[model samples]
Target: MKTEAQFENADVNMARRSFLHYAGAGMAALSVLSAASCKKDHSKPQMTTGIDIGATGDLAILNYAYALEQLEAAFYINVAAHMYTGASDDEIALLTDIRDHEVAHREFFKAALGTHAIQALTPNFSSINFSSRASVLGAAKAFEDTGVSAYNGAGYLLKSADYLLLAGKIVSVEARHASYIRDLISPSSFADSTVIDSNGMDKPQSIAQVLAIANGYLTTKVSAINYGYKAY
Candidate 1:
């Protein structure tokens, strides 16, 4: 028969294991709760300074992408809220879907970047006549095309393979948005020579090039001085 001391030691070990198992589970639950809280909390400190997407590194690239996503999300949200005159039911549904996707993209980067994420940007759409279908779709085309090119151009700058993979996934979605917008404006022009070269490859715009175009629609500016981009 086992001694009483041995029995007690066995009982202590079993109790310790049980405690650890529950503790591990608790930590996992806490992690999920923390992520949810981060996503739900939208009130971030207001920033008055222009956005410097960092000098160089994965964080800079991620921030650059984040800034673009923020602009696109804001634009799409407004478009959905005050849908253009003559917008078909199908058009509203599709535009709303685009808005949701952009919001998800924005939130994903915000969560992934955590403490390093840039503050929300304020977009200026005074030039866009939201009530007109031509104006709304035209702006959408510009935003979507710029987003696709921005991702393509910046993909090579990411040092992390994981980040690169994520960029590729996002750019593909942006491409789809670009194509859809193109078709809406002009049927069968989705993959025209403008986006697809004779070699059948999509064109990519450098950070400087993209920011120059994007800044036209934003009150805040985005810059990548560290990436040898200046005068934007």
Candidate 2:
């Protein structure tokens, strides 16, 4: 596979291969992120405020992941705060854990991007019944599953072996999170064919398609120009 790096002609990111395992585990604990002063500078054309995805590359790819993390973090955090009715204690605990992970992911990109990090995204959760535990978990499962597939689909696009490996590491966690939520929705729902293809591979969507599907659920339209994703 001719993987593309996350930035313009950046190195293949082979240098980090030796410690990629270490890097992935530490992804959640990343502090001192670039989010220091960088935030949503101004309102953009889309209902959601985000940076322009400049183009394909490592940084851009990170930004893309950051945006999604922001979305998930925000969603889960909100769910934790309001909490859906009929949610069990175990369900609450799992959702809280998912929230923490997303926060860590969001912060990781912020710290890594420094001045280049994008702004916070406002989610449109109109479609979600925050009052229903079943509805909430189902939607969370979809988002998490979609997130894993998104990263998996994009991983091959990253030429930097290090970034590709990093993506793999993160997506695996996302898959776990997705499975946890799915099982909560219904037993044996985690590995269902609705998400997996005949080849047993996870199905993925283009970012545009993902966002389009997500648009109905979110009130804001998060753009990816900052990450430099050309509409395919």
Candidate 3:
């Protein structure tokens, strides 16, 4: 008994609902596509240059220190993120504090470098298994000790009093961290034969030497040219 006009009106209403449903679904699909697109971007840290820091001597030494700090910072940050096995509460707390210190060191170098600062470095941690406590603590000890040695070795290379003082401050804290990790691993590894030289001074490595050992763990080669560090 309904009029044809009313029947037509109902058909039009159904068509509008169908259209809206399809429109909403299309919008949702578009949203997902947009998010996926964003995830594909791999843009990273950029490099800047032309600020003369001198012929890679003092500036180069600073750059070397900066690079090492970056490596240490990244490693500790990773350790904190995916903590290793058998990590005690105290160890975790202390290591986390060290991680914060490394980050500060990296940032300080970056700020001091100004326009000559190297780009953000990505660490290769594949050599050390993060899931195992032995691997993590072992790597931590190596890093901390190496950091201490690097500072001591490079201290003589730094012409600027400002830089030398900074290195001393950072390495002292690094040594403390190293000792703590050593004791945790074994009772007397801190001042043991592995780290301390016969003269009782910390064993040190030159910039070239340290880079050779540490650079293997990096995916990208770091250039010290801009910072006044000569490769040879």
Local accuracy by lDDT, each model: 0.77, 0.67, 0.68
| Model 1: how far residue 232 lies from native, Å | 0.7
Q: Identify the runs in model 3 with alpha carbons over 4 angstroms from their true place.
A: 1-54, 223-232
* Residue pairs clashing, model 3: 56-228, 56-229, 60-228, 60-229
Candidate 1 lDDT over 112-186, as tens digits, reads 666767788888999999899999999999999889989988899876666777788778989999999999999
Candidate 2, residues 82-159, lDDT tens digits: the string is 788878888778776776677666666665565667666667887788888777887898789879878976777765
TM-score of each model, paired residue for residue: 0.78, 0.74, 0.72
TM-score, model 3 to reference: 0.72
List model 3 lDDT by residue over 1-232, tens digit each: 4443453354334434444332333234334533553566534423523222233445556667777888887787777777887888998898878876776666666655555565676679899998898899889887888888888877997755655666787789899989998998898888987878899988887665666666766776565444434333
> Quick one: best lDDT, which candidate?
1
TM-score of model 2 relative to the true fold?
0.74
Top-down lDDT ranking: 1, 3, 2
